[model samples]
Target: MKWLLQLVLTLSVTFCFTTAQNPEAAGRASSWIGGAEHEGALRALKWLEEAQDLGDGGGGWGSDAPRALLALQLSNCSWIPNAGMKAELAATKLELQIALLLWRHHEPPISPGRLAQYTLALGAMCKDPRDFHGHDLISLLLRHEPESDFEFAFVTLAVCNSGSHARKRHIRRLLDVTGDTDKHSADTLAMVVLALRCVAQEHRHRDLLRFVAPPALALAALQQADGSFGNLHTTALAMQALEGAGAIAWDRGAAMNLVLSSQAPDGSFGDTFTTTEVVLALQSRGLAQVSQCKCNKPRLPPSDTELGNFTFS
Candidate 1:
């Protein structure tokens, strides 16, 4: 009886561990894109193909989604060119329908440049978007001066989300091609570093991780002892990098402790974006919520003053 019980327990533990790591459990269907067999990729591919449109590139409508889907299919190990080609047409049709719907809702057409970029990037996955030749156009659009840093973050996500090593490599090349890092604004550097770290994690690229550490560390040093940072978004980016590097000294509780001490009485974090961030940081390190801190009130809400400053644009 004891021997039989042991076997059952061992199997149970094994099953639980496997289930916990099941790639299917991730929120995004594409989360396991490269990690899964071609059959699984096909399911996601079919869904996106059925949902995309080829015509409406304005205001988020267009071939981009389908392009991403088709690219994932091509990247899958199970794809055969003939069958994949057939599926690609259906996907493009789906995207075009979606674009039409979007056009109906638009007050004015989206910018031509934006439309071209979205389509071309999508097209690179399979057929090219009309007029735009390749992902290069998308990269160019992402390079717009005002908010290139933030824009690139999304573009990297688009390519990386496709789960193609080639796409990831292309994104890396885009980063390398940008030689203007010397003129980057503080916000720009933070966004770029955020994208770099995100791509690194997606591909388990250790070299990229190392490359992003210096700027992350510099940002970390900029944090006051109180855990408040100069810029809320940049601070979030820095913390994300530190967490990824395993260099935040979280076990010692230095960073978490500093954040806790700085949280205001109202449960609202400091005037900047520090409150929720500090709470989340503490949680990541296995600490309780700030409201549950033994020294504080039972509950508190983040203040409007703090919230307003960081309100989503």
Candidate 2:
């Protein structure tokens, strides 16, 4: 039976590799940060830089999560030596810093900024950032803007090492922030649950727990039996929520085991951006595990020219 289960997982992974379509930005970013080929990681970063929000210097408009995600990915690539890689990383860092500054100091309802975006992006850069930043970036995030699901969840992860007071403040702020927003689409709702669950785990809040229960249960009920989620990023975030909300007991060993067994051989994930986000989330959890999956596809040599070489920028 054990061998049979391994066979099934192997076959399922093989089929996914044979059929993957457009490279998912999230998955690729995760793999790169986890130490995949430098060129492949660069390509993913390039995609993210190109996709930046030109409208705002920070990267994009309201809650530009993708651009934020990509910038952080570029930041993680800082260890590389290639000129193109270095340049791209530098650009993303500046863009993300600018965005973070905007979120902290900019007016209006403090939407997720370069810092928040960079938070997840940075998660992709390496294992995690628990030891990376010194100043309370989460406090910076709260002071500047209204809390949302994304912000709450991110701040909780960011403040893992922070003292108790700040954790409560962030969690309270998250609950307060999402209470008023009308953005209850399935995805947004999932984001809200994600935030609440994480915060709740660190510092239990009855109100937040009450608020998150229905959605959290709904999301867990939605998980497929094969462990393949309906949506990749959503599933990943939902996992965070479940773990946070105490739905799944915080067993790092068990969780890591489940994740290892579920990962695709190509080092990518099961759903969209599967590779990128799975790595990011796992790293954020402080798992030092590296990806065992390798691409069977031919490796591309790094191009010496900049991305804009073919077209006028």
> By TM-score, who's the top model here?
2
Clashing pairs counted in every model: 9, 9
Badly placed stretches (over 4 Å) of model 2 are 1-113, 119-136, 151-215, 224-230, 243-274, 281-313
What are the lDDT figures for the candidates, one per model?
A: 0.39, 0.42
Tens-digit lDDT string for candidate 2 (192-298): 66655444443433345666765555555555655533455655555555655555423434433455566554443443244445544544331111111121212
Q: For model 2, name the residue pairs that clash.
A: 26-276, 27-275, 27-276, 30-276, 53-59, 99-114, 110-145, 269-274, 269-275
lDDT of 1: 0.39
List candidate 1 segments past 4 Å from native.
1-105, 108-147, 158-187, 204-206, 246-258, 261-313
Give, for candidate 2, the lowest lDDT window spanning 10 residues: 286-295
Residue 93 alpha-carbon offset, candidate 1, angstroms? 26
- Give the per-residue lDDT of model 1 (tens digit) for 95-127: 444344333444664443344334433433343
lDDT of 2 at 80: 25
The number of clashing residue pairs in model 1 is 9
